[model samples]
Target: MNARLPERQASRALLIGSSRFSHEGLHDLPATVNNVRALADALTDPALGGLDPSGCRVLTDPTTPQQVGDAIDGVVNEALDTLLVYYSGHGMLNQRGELFLAVETTDPDPRRVHYFGVPMGWLRSALADSPARNRILILDCCFSGHATQAMSGTAPAVSGNLDIHGTYTLASAPAHETAVAPVGAQFTAFTGELLRTLRQGVPDGGELLTLGDIYPALTRALLASGMPRPQRLGTGMADHIALARNRAYRPATPSTVKPRTVSEPRGTTITPGVRSTNEQDPKVAAEFHAAMLDGYRRAKKELNYNAGNFIQMVQQVGGLEAARRLLRASSVSSGFTTLWEKGRLDLAVEAVVLQDRFAGLFSDEELDIARDRLAEYGYSPAQTS
Candidate 1:
């Protein structure tokens, strides 16, 4: 099922790419250009959406705060039908827990983020005020997940303090994590999968690349590759919603195989560049688990306690099953980071691979829960806060 987008309607996208920074300490991102080209090309391809060049705004290496605002305003003004905001740059989380997008002139110091970074709240507010109902934000930067949280409508907004809805914030990483641009890949890991999806189309022969159709494949690719997982909220579309058409797709016979379930456990892989730091050290592993247990006990907050992916794994896949899944991934731990970093593929997998042992850390009881509060964190609050 797909969300019914306005047929034969015009679509507009604001593509912002910040590859270089004025500060010497900040790393330059050469792959952002590749992301912009790939996204614009995919959106513009005749076989896909065929959006006219006039409708899309492409901004590169914008430095001023007003420049970012103006570009977003342009998209909001054009949001009569479909609109997408794609930003590839630095994403910072300040001491106040607010998120800012780093511009070309952004200061390297975290304390000075307010002066140099573009307020993420501005985009949220712009999208909320826009007449358009279908809005999508593809944030490919560090702490980009912060966009999932609704920005406080105040002058300097913090996420999750407000209640804004209807925008799909597809973030490249969880809070506090950095999105990686692989050494050999032409694009960032997050955008590379998106490009591949556009090129290959869904396993199903549907020409339209709906969010639902692409999500599983994306998760599989990123999780298998051990990169920061991209997250999405089913905003504006209760079902699959068309973003672009699959250029390479054609009609085909219906298959017997079913699509992967969202609740199903995903395979884990050791991510590239993850150091072996303390991975094999028993004392370090013990200390990490101890801290986790202590924190959960102290908080007495189920939200915080179960917020751990490991616990979520247990809940979704059952204690034994989750452990088995983790164990399978651990044998090939070269791709995963150390356990101290909250990596799933840990050396301790062997010891906790049983339900009885794992349950000691987390309960086996079923949860009939509400996603309302969690839904508020549409941006990716789990990453930083």
Candidate 2:
């Protein structure tokens, strides 16, 4: 069966990552903090997870179990379709071998684990009680595989009470294994791989990436890298839920340009990847350069565009070609769609590039793409006024 994407409007996500710990026994995991922030960005990205930013709550280094519990309760109550809860950091097992999620103030002493750490049973209870039709739990930490066991009613922690219907659990490691976190890495081993999978996307996978598609790939990649093999448990159609858009997906109609190698005045080879800055016709490049700067300013002032890489790209590729590249994209560029979603596509650089005055600069196929994308969004050239 084909996986279905969750309703972006009705789904909610809660991301919790404990990066710092007060007790010296529980070493700090700096990568966990970056994991939460980066995962949040990837999930809310317009072209990726497509989740509303407001619906995805991120908690880093939570102070208390109540804080995390309340957040989970809030999302569980609000979400009518799907509820996703992701936790990355330390996972501790008390004297009874029950799993507890460690927080900033959690004590390594198993006796006091209940005081600060959040119990795995609490999550099972919340999921079992939630009205949402789909529930997804992702854990990235030591002994995370115990979560799968807990959900299956085989674990001593929440024995015989794992009645979480329509729930899916993805764990970073087996119950007895400790998840790897390499020193100086930006994110933990499991979460870093997850982020990479989400961003780089599966080249041969379907347009929408489901749990079934991701888990196998993650397992192969992690095991190949000498990391612990991840585990998964899914009930009902939970495995068929789509989590992200395939970044490597191609449209039916191709818009790729085969570049012709050109030599500069000094015999420097300009390949497809090398963009010309100063060698191009000054007049043509200057016109587009001016338009680009104007639109950049307008987008920043009006649409709150804060992407720093955009300016860097303009400088590297030169404004004239940069505008043309956006126009030639098979689908609307994410940056342009971001502006359109902000209710200010009229001020976008793509809009300026598509103007009649600059029509001659771009090919007919390229112009068609730019116009089609705007029209798809119900945007008109007259909207510029």
Candidate 3:
């Protein structure tokens, strides 16, 4: 029998990623930013993890341990069924052989690390004390396997006794090995595979995905890719807990399956680097219009705008129509910089219009305008599209 999905209202997840570090020795990891955001989206997706948006919290480039600790405690206090904590960044080992997760302000020096870095022992204690029945810790960083070493009895005595009763710990690499963050990639290699597994799902699998289902798959995929094999430590029924709905599940009746024609046009031939001009079916068009409006509203709130200029444009012309007009304009829009500053250039009308799923909805010229405008703001077609 497959494991059960966590109840949406009773579960909480905290996703933390640090891309930039203040210490001179730690190089920036631009991909970590994308990792957290994409994972948050996947976890909160209605058809995937089914977690409520409010329950999935994301912290990018957190500066201090207290900030992360507070966020973790906040969720741990609220979660009744499941509590998941994920971290992606540099993992450091101090002189005493204790593992620490590097934050933006973390110093590499052994003495200073104790004060700046977030200790893995702290997380162990929190998980041990958490009231949630199911606890999960996924660490994607160098030396992350040390976090689970306590379970094997090779770690410090204090850490060995700190293992939680009902927890599943998944580390990206072995204790001494460094995790891969491929150059120019959208995510760290380990997390990229994790996201791919969630998005693509296991073929011919059960209705829901359990840790038992995902762990072996990840091991095989990572080894085949020549990446480091992951390490997992599960206590009690942790492996039986479902994390996501299987996307690849098929029913007995073929006719009952909905065709995926809405997201990708069936007969349309689109050119490379250019959007197709084909008109969509009414249902598809209506959905695209709604998404455009929704994206606009989110951008307004994210930008914290009180001025009605952009809102008026969107209201009068409709979001998609306004996007069409914006794409055709020669000058960059005023809101582009602010959106970019907030790491939400994706919310900009120009970027939103270029989504891959909306490939056939816009013309080549209009798409070019969107692409060019985004290029001026430092987004390449690969990043925007």
Q: Over all chains combined, what TM-score does candidate 2 have? A: 0.64
Cα shift from native, residue 27, model 2 (Å): 0.8
Cα lDDT for residue 64, candidate 1: 84
Q: Which stretches of candidate 2 lie over 4 Å from their true place?
A: 161-165, 250-385
Clashing pairs in 2: none
Q: How close is candidate 3 to the true structure, as a TM-score?
A: 0.64
- Residues 285-367 of candidate 1: C-alpha lDDT, one tens digit per residue: 45445543443343334223233445555556644455345433301121111221233322233323211222222221110
Model 1, global lDDT: 0.59
What Cα-based lDDT does every candidate model obtain? Answer: 0.59, 0.77, 0.77
Cα lDDT for residue 150, candidate 2? 87
Model 1 quality (TM-score):
0.63
Clashes of each: 11, 0, 0
lDDT of 3 by residue, 82-153 (tens): 899999999988888778999999997877787899998777777778888889999999999998885444
Estimate the overall C-alpha local distance difference test score of candidate 3.
Answer: 0.77
Global CA lDDT of candidate 2, please?
Answer: 0.77
